[model samples]
Target: MRSFVYARPETIDGAVSEMTAEPGAAYLAGGTTQVDLMKDEVLRPVRLVDITRLPLREVWSDGDALVVGALVSMEELAGHPVVTERLPLLREALLMGATPQLRHMATMGGNLLQRTRCRYFRDPSVPCNKREPGAGCGAIDGFHRTHAVLGTSAHCIATHPSDAAVALLALGAEVRVRGGEGERVVPLTDFYRLPGSTPHVETVLEHGELITHLEIPLLPRGARSGYLKVRDRASYEFALASVAAALVVEDGTIRRAHLALGGLGTVPWRVPRAEELLRDAAPGEESFAAAADAALAGAVARPDNGFKIELGRRAVVRMLSTLAKES
Candidate 1:
């Protein structure tokens, strides 16, 4: 790893200022993903500003939302009483993301800011538009079985690998960030940038903006939500196809349905077409199948990963069915 200066500012403003002063400096929270990239020489930040000591670990309920401080550890958030009681889907997603030991060190902000797990981007030897813009993409006709099928561009096709963010997208969560100008709250769905002509730009955050907290607006009291992940193994591997589905059923039909797909898109894929199909439809095989089909309507799968189209559909169908049964 390259040598870099380290700083642990006592205040958020100070930390932000330090990062703003050095555009190449990276804000370090749990040091999980950032550390790995540094060792690989893929990311050579001239400085590392530690934000662990900052008082950003608070997790509580606001008037009608769940406010999660950015520095809150994944383990703590997943096991928090409020999370288990009000957001079981979030708990399940966090627990499924990483092993116990890693979860203890992974922070909320870090997870959301986690980089894509595309092999081309990770292996500095290979060319990746995301890693080095305009260098060319090696995964175009290379090993793309685990790459994205949605929100992909000619420059890049990398799948987002955040389980918590996918659940948050379905739950309609927003992130509060402290930037150079001021503080702002951005919806999770809009925070990530698509790999368009400029695949290097990943998120909407400015150079030194710090994510302060995440807010999940209150959900219906009796709504049923769950996450289903399909992977190559049962261990803490990345998701091949995952679905976070929340459904509110009244009488015998669906009242409101929220669906987000992961491991199949460039971001937390919110399937509005699928939600439109299940908004007022009855909970059954036919409706669920239709919703699943709508979710994959725009999927353009690569040759090796064409199976993901069907696999992603099945995941959505299964999650909706499970939520329907529970509701």
Candidate 2:
């Protein structure tokens, strides 16, 4: 790794000030993703502002919402009593992600900000728009079996690789960001940006901004939620297609539904149209199929990834069916 200046800030204001003053300064929490990128030379920040000492490691309930601090580790959140009992879908998504060792070190904010695993983006040798804008994307024509099918632009087609983010999106979570000016709460749906002409910019966060926490409204009493991941392997692998679903059924009729997809889009894909189709419908294969169709309606596939469209549709149907059964 390259040599860089390091600073450990005791306060959020100090960290933001130090980072804002430097053009190439990065916040370091668990360093799970940042260290890997630095080792690969994909990211070379001039300074590292360590915010591990910041008082952001608390998870609690606030009225009808669950508040999760950015510093909370994946394992810690997955095993927390309140999380397991109240947000089982999130717990399942967290557990299905990286192995135990990584979960212990990966924080909630770090996981959401983790970069894509695209080979071209990771290897500095290849041309990738995400790694270097206007350089062209090699994954567009290269082995793109794992590339995205939804929200793909001619400039980039890399898939997002965050299991937690998909579940969080499905749960309608909001992010709390702290910056030089002040603080703002951004909805999770609006946080991620599509891979448009500017694929290099993936999120709405500014350069010096720091994610403080996330808030998710608690589900209703009769709600049933779960997560399903289909990958090439059973363990220690990323999802090929995954779904996070929550449904509320009343007297054999669906009252409300929320569905989000991962491993098939440039961002964590939320299918509001699919959710709308499920409303007031009977919980059956026909309704599930219609919702699945709506989920993949705008999907466009490359030569090597056309199978993902069908795979993603099946994942949606299966996840919804499982949740409906639970209800």
Please provide TM-scores, in order, for all candidate models, with all chains considered together.
Answer: 0.98, 0.99
Candidate 2 TM-score to native: 0.99
| Candidate 2: stretches off by over 4 Å | none
Candidate 1 C-alpha lDDT tens digits along 145-213: 988889999999999999999999998999999978989999988999999978889899999999999
Quality of model 1 by C-alpha lDDT: 0.92
Clashing pairs in 2: none
Task: Give the best candidate by lDDT.
Answer: 2
